[model samples]
Target: MKNDPNFIAAYGNIPTFESLEEREKWLDTLDKIYTEVNDNFEKEMSKYFYPNGPVIAYGYTIDGVLKVAIEKGQKIDAAKENELYDLFSNYGQNIAVKDVPLIIVYEDLPTPTSRTSSWRPIIGGIKICTEKPDGIKQSTLGFSAQTSSGTKGYVVAGHTAPSIGDQIWQPTAGPSANKVGTVSKVGGHYADASWVPYSNVAAKIYDTDTDVLKDVKSHENAAIGDTVYKSGITTGRSYGSVTEIRTSYDNPLGTLYRQYVAGYNCDGGDSGAPVYVYVSGGVKIVGIHWGGVGTYNSGYSTSIFSPVSGVQSDLGVTPLTA
Candidate 1:
C-alpha cells in the first residue's frame, strides 16, 4: 500500500518508517491528539458518570480494552450513550453494556439489620457495629487479624468512624450483651480499614451458604481480571470479577485512591466485609469492601474495596492466615 499511488490518493499520505523507533515517532502526533481530547473529555463527561443517578462508572482495562466503564441501568439518562458517542467520536467509542464483558449486577437483596444474639467465637462476614450500631452505623467485619505484637483482633470498614478505645459489638443491633471488642488501630488514606481487638476468634469467615467456617490461609492483591467474592451479612456471599484497580472515589471519609472495584452486588451494612479468592488450601483475602454506586456521595452502587496490602500497611496488623 505504501508504494501504491492509487491507494495513497484514495486515502491520505501514509507515514514512512524503516525502523520500530521510526514507527512510534510517526505515531506520536496521533497519540498527542488522543491524549488531549481524552483529558478534556474527562472534564466534560462528568455529567454522565456514575452517581449521576444510581449508576456505577469508572475507567479501567478489561480483556485488554481500556474503557470509560459505566454500568447500564434503567435510572440512567436514555441519551447517555448518544451523548457519550458524540463526545468520543474522534478520540474513542462506547460499547453497549450487553457487549461489555464485565459489569456490576445489582441484586439489592436487603437482609435484616439485626442478627443473632451472639456467636461464641467471632468471625468475618457477620455484622459488627459501634456502640450505637443504629443499623446505618453497623457494617460487616472484614476479617480476623493480629497486631505485630501478637494482639488478636478483627478488621472492619474505617468509614464506620473508627477511633481508638471505641467499643464495638457483633451484630448491628447490640444491646451491650453482645459486646465483642474495641477499636485498637485504624487504617487511613487509600484503605478504608480499621482493627478491633478481641480475645475470642475462629480466625476464619462465617460462610452463609455452606453454613460452615472457611479458613483464610493467606492474603493477596486484586488484579484487573481476577474473580473476587464478597461475604457480608446483608448480601451473603456473592461473586464478581475485578474490573477496576487504582480507582478513586470521593466521599465523606476522604477521596480514596488505588481502590479496587469488583463487578459484584452489595448493599448497606455490607461494608467492611472481606473480599477474596479461593486459594489452593484456603482463601487468600484480597480487599475490604466499602461503599460503591449509590445515592450517597455520587455513589456508583459498585463494590469498592481497599486491598489487603494497603489495609495491612495502614493498620500494622497481619491477616491471620493460619
Candidate 2:
C-alpha cells in the first residue's frame, strides 16, 4: 500500500510511531495481511500448476508438487506414492544434491601437466623408428594387460602387436610413464593389449599414474558422485565427476562393462591412460581408460574404464605406492 499514508506511517519510519504498543499492533496487522494474501495466491496458483500424475520435481524445497508436464493417467500407489511425493515436496526448498545437472564441456584442450602437479613426459612424443615400419603402421593405442605371473602392465593403444620379447620404453621420469618396464604378453584383435612385468615397474611407478592402483583404502571402493582425474600420453591431464558406475557397453573391440565417468576428453593415444580419484591427501588410481563412447570432435561424452581391482588381480601385482 504505497498509496496509503496511514499504513505507511504506521509501519514505515520507526521513531514516527506514536508508541511501542502501536508499533507492535501495526506489525501484527501486517503479518496477518501477508499470510492471508499468500494463502490466496497459493490456492489460485495450485489450479494452474496441478501435477498431471506420478512424476515429481526432485529439487524443490517445499511440498513436492507434480508438474503438469508429467505423463498423466498412470496408476500410482496411494500410500507409497504419497510418501515419495512428500519427500520431494517438503524437501524442495532444501538444497538438493541431484538438482544440478552438469554435462562435460570442453573449456580448452588440455596440455600435459595442466591438471596434475605430478605430470611429466611419458615417451618423448612417439617417434616413428623407420620410414617403412612393419606390422600395422605403428599407431599408438591404449591397453591394460596382466602377465601369467600376475604382474599388471599398461599398454599404449595401436594396431601394432608387440611380441613377448618386444622391448618397450617409457620415460623413467615425467608426468606420463615414470618407470620403464618390458612387454610380457599381448592380446586383443589389433594387438591393442600387452602385458608388462609388474614387479619391475611397481617400485618405479606412482599409484597416481594408473587407474588400476590406489593407495587409499577408503577410496578402494569408489561410488557415484566421486570426482576423478585422468592422465594420458595424449590430452595429458583432465578432471571430471563420476556419473555412473559398474556399467556396460559394446564396442568394436568387444562387449565390455565397467565403471564409467564423465567430463574428461581423451584421444587416440590416450587409450592406456590411467584414471585417478582425487582424495583427501592425494590422488589414487582407480581404473584405466579403455575407450571413449562418444565422438572425439565435440568431446562432451562418456568414457569407460576398467577398474583397478580387476587389473590388479589379473596382473598379480601389488598396488602402486603413492
Candidate 3:
C-alpha cells in the first residue's frame, strides 16, 4: 500500500528525516494535511448520506479518501451493498471526481448503545454500566489525573454516567465488588469521557504482558500510523495502529472532533481504555478508547479514541505520573 501511486501521491509525499524531532515535525505537517482533507471530504460528502439516506458514517481513510459506512441491508443508487462494494473496490481509486479528491468505499456497520457498568475495578480495567434502557454496557477506566484543585480522579466514558454523581462501581451488580468512584463531571458534547474523583483505584495500568503496573507519565496527540496499546477487561491488552487522526465521527452520543481511529480489537467494556505509545523511556498517553464499528475481526473494523490532550484540557486535569 505504501508504494501505490495514489497512496504515495496523497499520503507518502511527506519529507523523510533521520532525527526524531524532524520526523515528528514532518508527521505534524502530514497530520494537518490529512485533517484538512478529512474536513473537506466531510463537508462535501456528508450531505450525500444520512437523513437523506442510509449512510451512517462518512470519514477519511489513511489513503486520504472518503469512506462511508451504511447500515446493513441499506442500498444506494439502486445498487445492492455487495455490488456497490465491487464497483468501488475495482474502480473507485481510478475515478478523480472532486477537487478535494475522494475514493469512496462502503462498509456495513452500526452503533450499539451502552449497557450497565459492571466489572473488576482495576485502574485500566473495565468499567461497565447501563444507560437506562440500553441494558448492560462497558468502558475502560483511564488512569487518574490531578484536577485543577489538586484532587485526583480517574476517567471513564461520559455516556456511562447518564447523570452526574452516579455511583460508579467495579462490578455493576455483584456483591463482592465495591464502589470505586462517582461521576464527578461528564463532558457530554465535548468528549466521551468523565472524571471519577475520590476513587479507591490507583493511578496505574495493569500490564497484561508483564502482569505488572505501568504509571502513565504524560498525554499526547496521536499521529496516523502510530503504534498504540490499550488494556481493558474484555479484550485485555490490545496493540493497534492509529489509522486516522483529526477526524470527526457523528453518532447518537454527539459529534466528536479531533478524534482518531485505531485497528485495535476492542469490545464494548473497553471504552475509556487508555491509548499510549512507548517512548524513549516511559509511556506517552495518546487517547481514551471509546466506541467502535464494523466486524471486530474484520480488517475494516475500527475503535474510536478521544485525544488524551483534549480530554485533559477540557476536564482540567493532568495525568498522574510516577
The positional error of residue 248 in candidate 2, measured at the CA in angstroms, is: 4.3
Instruction: Give lDDT: candidate 3, residue 169.
Output: 58
Best by TM-score: 3
- Name the lDDT value of residue 100 in candidate 1: 21
lDDT of 2 by residue, 67-101 (tens): 11111333434453344333333333243223311
Write model 1 residue lDDT over 204-293, tens digit each, in one string: 887566566689988988776689988887777877887655334434354344577677777777888889888877788888888654
**Alpha-carbon RMSD of each model:** 11.1, 18.3, 7.3
Clashes of 3: 16
Deviation (Å) of 230 in candidate 1:
0.5
**How would you encode candidate 3's per-residue C-alpha lDDT over 33-106 as one tens digit per residue?**
44444455445434545555555554455544434455556545534444433333333233432123333334
Candidate number with greatest lDDT: 1
* Model 2 accuracy (lDDT, Cα): 0.37
lDDT of each: 0.62, 0.37, 0.58
Q: Candidate 2: which stretches are off by over 4 Å?
A: 1-167, 171-181, 185-193, 198-221, 246-253, 298-301
Error of 1 at 315 (Å): 0.7
